[model samples]
Target: MDRFRDRQQAGERLAERLVALGYGREPQVLVFALPRGGVLVAHPIAQRLGAPLDVWVVRKLGVPGHEELALGAIAAGGGRVLNEEVIRGLGIPAEAIAQVEARETQELLRRERFYRGERPPPELGGKVVLLVDDGLATGATMKAAIAAARAQRPARLVVAVPVAPPEALREMEALADTVVCLKAPPDFRAVGLWYERFPQVSDEEVLYLLRVS
Candidate 1:
């Protein structure tokens, strides 16, 4: 059975788990949502915990013909993580890496501008940074986000998701100080399969959440 009705319900239920874990009581807490769908999953959590919410843009660098297969990812403030094994196995060239990075860098900047206007990104130093995403797949995007959050030197770094495959959750634990995945079903496949009403989150909704929530 699907565990969540939608992103909002997932966020609410996830927040309850976080609160039980004592994150809701922590000082210097900041919720950073991986934008678009993640923002939806983050909104209610941030609201429930009274933590300030912000967006972190991470772009996936997909393998050239198989665009869905991520070779690497780029995060805000020039943070990046590359999959050396994938690159070597695919024999991807350095030039291709540079090209993909450059393109994603531009897209990252565009998202920041569109989302925040003239406002600068929130500071992460000395804070308990909660990285929220709807779910984890290959985890490339969240890995880049973890690197980016680490660059800012947060006091603590955590990753929270509604559902994820057990293997990916285990791998993410090495990068994040705490990983709170509500569901880690052994038969995991796509993230959407665990939600009853999964749908594409629009840019307008992301902007609205930032402004209103």
Candidate 2:
């Protein structure tokens, strides 16, 4: 709603909702945020909940000709997702997928270095993990992140975002243990639209946030 000036405000609102929903307790409630927008959001929530804040890097694999359209996604440690419909519709060969994944993997590593430096990933096993993002569209990257988290055997996996398309929000529920989206508009064009100040978050900014936290 208009209550959120940006992701930070949205996260504060979301944290209040979470506390109301009964995730107010101890060590099990961990917040894992995707950079760079999610970091801003997660910071407030982590402080409010006394939860450990961390990052989970995942990148989208965009389809040829429609770079905005996700063909699938990939996360660290080789976790991957493929959109069968996009692949078939675009006639994207298996080799093509491999090529995209390969490139994206490089970008993923770059992001991880930019955002994480030498910090290790937090323990996820047996924890009630809440994954945060600014928003979602195809949800391919978030799906991959969920898969990666599942490997760590979290007690529960929750996907939370400030906004998303209604259809994408539904799809996210199938992957995570819970979905906590603030808005799911039918006319959801992009994540930026929901915010008044959706500035481009540079890699420098990402690194700065990581450093501060």
Candidate 3:
């Protein structure tokens, strides 16, 4: 498959696929993007669907030192899901998990404040919510986001991404009412690999996108 020119292009493609799948005309649709990368991808989708755009902040509980390796993740509204296999395999103690959780929870709140400001999060009850992310890897953060969304009693929950591994999509199927993945290459590595210009999306960019919409 050809790599997307950038996140915006990937999002456009995802939006097209989503519309083809019968989501474009839904009146109750709401787009909850996982910032900061998801914001760029979601803005176009929101515009195309004429839906409200918002952020769903989720923080990874990274393993000590090896910060890229996620032990689990925590999302807004006190939703947390830990990877027990990773924890036990790494011999991470309960105390370590608690510490990591505390730290991540703080960061999650900080991000929420930074992104949404004084505005309370939008109510999801009875809404068909679309959880947008640039891509999925370990899927920990997305899982936590799904849990948090479930707490709000949305009428329907869907997870959408431009690219993800086949295995990750399979795992997400049981969590979300629908999972829309554009590309699930067998040799999938990182999400960036499928994009020609996967730049680091800055906070300023996220703020601009949120304010513009």
Candidate 4:
């Protein structure tokens, strides 16, 4: 709990641990940060490795009545991952997905413009793509992100984060070539609790980081 005093500190710590993990040269590596908080953790990492840092926007589909529960998630490039189990068992109609998609799609486009401006996403066709997020909770959103990224045909996919529940980490491990999470608390309650400073990352910050760093 006292390991990091704040998000910046946590980012530094994660970078140090990652450097030790030996993923190789920063310039050659392609690092994708999930905005907006993930960018905060990833900036230090990108700085350390001299890698080009960019944001990968992904949004979750909240269940119709239970917003906290993820019914599915969607990512860029027509990438989608649906909880088939929920859809079949809970009887979520297509109308529900359509509604969620409409709302989430608007935000996704807005974020793309807000975070990337005119810059285009880097090529991931044959490079090691390191996906960074502040932390993992339900694993739903990241799952969609990873699946979305994989469609771009990156040679390798790695998931990096500062903290996540052990179960979530394990689920992610199978989805990615590797996982570089710094801490896996058994009883991880929430991503915020793991961080000493978990302030809400702003839209301007995401745009700024993508532009300069």
Q: By descending TM-score, how would the candidates be arranged?
A: 3, 1, 4, 2
Global Cα lDDT for candidate 3:
0.92
- What's the TM-score of each model vs. the native? 0.97, 0.92, 0.98, 0.93
| Model 4, CA-based lDDT | 0.84
Model 3 per-residue lDDT tens digits across residues 87-150: 9999999998899888888888999999999999988999999999999998999999999999
Give every collision pair in model 2. none
Residues 32-78 of candidate 2: C-alpha lDDT, one tens digit per residue:
88877888888778888888777888888987667778999998756
lDDT of each: 0.92, 0.83, 0.92, 0.84
Candidate 4: count the clashes: 0
Model 1 alpha-carbon miss at residue 134, Å: 0.4
Off-target runs (Cα >4 Å) in candidate 1 are: none
After best superposition, candidate 2 residue 101: deviation in angstroms? 0.6
Candidate 3, TM-score vs. the true structure? 0.98
Candidate 4, which segments miss by more than 4 Å at Cα? none
